[model samples]
Target: MLDPDRIRVVAPHFKRRLSGVTSTVVQLIPAQRRRGLGIATLGPGLPETMPALSFAQLPALWKKPKGAAHRVWHARRNVEMLAGIVLRDLLRMPLKLLFTSAAQRHHSRYTRWLISKMDAVVATSARSGSFLKVPHTVILHGIDTDLFHPPEGVDDTIAGTSLPGEHLIGCFGRVRHQKGTDLFVKAMIELLPRYPSWTAIVSGRVTAEHKGFADGLKADIARAGLSERIVFLGEVDDIKPWYRRLTLYVAPSRNEGFGLTPLEAMASETAVVASDAGAYREQIAEGMTGAVVAAGEYEPLRDAIEAYLADPGRAHLHAKAAVAHVRADFALAGEAAALEGVYSRLLGVPATSPQS
Candidate 1:
């Protein structure tokens, strides 16, 4: 637990379910703490080991921290933004509210009103920033390279299950229409038979609403006799190892909010083929690190993935470049330092260099 009095910033995760926002909070808090930022999380669904303050401890916000004039209440969702308002406005707490927006669409009137109350705003991507009427800083999302790095050796087999083929291609996210799962399946069905040594894997949850959609895709795979060649491994606890096993990773989302899977895959030393959705185009270097196709377009996506599958050596070369790209530009440490600078400005404190 972080000492309540020492906390200069509070990051709240109001939602209990694991989501992109929750994942960001989980990955970012520790990195911020490593930078000597007096930050702590509040609410459920986070690891117990993380520095956290209980709801009962909300009263502590009435007092200022050791060095800062006011505590920064950093929010990523509407509910969290509301909570910050309640704490700062209703209860008269010494807090400066900050909100980070990742949605690429225009904000509703209610949402715009909430954003207007923020002391500072951060947009996760330039596309996301364009939707904001208020001035904001653009801070692209980064991943923990240490957690998602190249494998020690070449290993294709996934322990506990029989996933054959010398090389593996993967698309990981929710198995729904928005994620373009069917497009990946269609591409695999057409290409996997031609390339006998390669297999395709789809790893993500199939929600109750998307069960029919998932069932239909499976039926198509069964009809094509590619059930063995193309597999679905629902949701797994640790996705890092899966990234390490992949030769190429694809993010075929028809829509997204600053997608991080491509960055995760690149850090795992795997090349990517992603749709021009979210911040994918900004992350991928076209022919260098990977390829980006028109969002929801079937032919272009298929052709891009085929290009990687056709030349294994080319894929390996691209994967090496991707690893270097992510390390140089998207390390978690860089994000932590950038966010710390934002927090410093909000708290009226001088920014300090992050500890190595």
Candidate 2:
């Protein structure tokens, strides 16, 4: 054991193993293909090398409480079996807790309750951490630079649509309710006229809840008569070129567990102009890396965008600086080493050298 301390790791069920395996291949499949700001810097494996566990075949369900109780019983037994598969890890693994999604208010509460049974906890972002009363460590997620790095070159074919003076700004991520696309779209409408040539791009799949919100954005864009200035690229397999063509990255999420999209943008060398979500507290260095407007405040975001548009040299400097900061503070190897240390500490035994 590396640390010899009391520990436990509870891996939450996200998707079926098959689906999980498919996830890597379908998108950002490996180190070379990582995307969305922060890449391998956040976890142990590249998209390709991530550990894939076999799913337990679903047994037939029973109708009565007895049947449901039986299911619960097996689930616990299955959990123990999983613990066994992890071997001593079950004993030494840190109670390192992390939850996902932002809009699900109960998720944080329930996760905290579940983790209360353990010795320690970890939060991927501040918003989640804020919900926890437990003593916890925060390990900001990292991004895979190899995959999400800026494209070899940038050719702004869309530049022709930009206002005579404004810069091209873009945002990307899952189109979901709490992501604050409404705020961003509204801000763009307000800001578009200030910088006539400036255009904003919102890309990704908007979820059902946000579908209406996304439509509102389209309507607003049309009303502003900036149809040519604003574009929704939807989801794309590659965002690397987007990074190189953009002057800034915007993440206007109403809530974020860790704001993975910002990390992706950072990894892609696009300095952020994001909402002051709890997660941004750890990543953005205010004026250095990018502006952190008050959470979901369109005015500040627009102001920041304007400031950057007016000074491309300044924006470029921040862009390079943000990337350098990520490389230094949140690189994949560093993240892996930190996680390994936690794991080793949880294992409670020293890792021996190969020859020894």
Candidate 3:
């Protein structure tokens, strides 16, 4: 919950829980307006799941694409949902586009096109810029450092050694194709016997056809004789402790904008071994924060994991460096302030009040 004077952004599930972030900025900007902030959002469709668009903005829409023309087209259609948002909200001055390109294939092109026309772009990741074809100020999605801080004397409490502790290489997010859990399972079969203590815990659920993927994943794990080693903890609401518990964090995705999972693990002081996704390059130095290997190559993937397992001293050094490195650059309060600066620039107002 936020304080009375703060601005609120009602985000749906995919957008991170912004409560911790929005609240912090309210304290920093002392002269902020009493009315707080006015938000311009990507439309959340309409009530009754029937598209309802405002009458005034209907004319501003471009001709419907051949596919959606039947469903959202004008003339016979009472309200053109996509058009209404473009004309009504965007195309107005001073817009802050808080969008997710991850679902661009599903969103109306007119809406996506309109964002490229925004006064300024604040993308959560580097991919946002590429998707929009705009030079975006990478805000590097905010994390509540308080919730994800490194534990004290963490090295002492950590039981995992190359051989001493349980050999658990955990994947923190959902088990889906994009995540490449199938590949991880294959790699585990090749490596688990060499390190008996190793376990692969894949958390989160699958839907519809992807449910088949989960079943196949389990079957693979069982076939490899590592079923005892492969544990699935589905849909965890809190993932911080899971980071601390793991010997290393694995991100095998073919794509990532600014994979926050690695950064979060770094903050928890977990040594990370991730795909060389765009953002990972910015955060994890090869032998520093953690190592980054080419995405989707099984042999290299196995080597990176084996390298870490074989050398606890290097992993420990990288883990400690990762926590310290992220804390310096990825601080949430600092990011909120930078976001505030972007907002201030749009309003032709300086960040600090004009001499009160």
Output the number of the lDDT-best candidate. Answer: 1
Cα lDDT of model 2 by residue, 121-179, tens digit: 45555565666666755655566677667635425324433333356688877766677
lDDT per residue for candidate 3 within 290-339, as digits (tens), equals: 87888777788778888877776677788889887878888665555666
TM-score of each model, in listed order = 0.97, 0.70, 0.70
Candidate 3 pairs with clashing backbones: 167-197, 167-198, 204-235
The model with the greater lDDT, 2 or 3, is 3
- What's each prediction's clash count? 0, 27, 3
List the candidate 2 regions with Cα displacement exceeding 4 Å: 1-13, 16-50, 56-109, 125-130, 155-166, 351-356
Candidate 1 deviates by what RMSD?
1.5
What lDDT does the true structure give each of the candidates?
Answer: 0.91, 0.55, 0.56
Instruction: Report the poorest 10 consecutive residues by lDDT, candidate 3.
Output: 69-78
For candidate 1, give the lDDT of residue 318: 95
Query: Which has the greatest TM-score?
Result: 1
Q: Write the per-residue lDDT of candidate 1 for residues 91-179, one digit (tens) a residue.
A: 99999999999998989999999999999999999999999999999998888988889887545334324677778899999999999
1 against 2, candidate with superior TM-score: 1
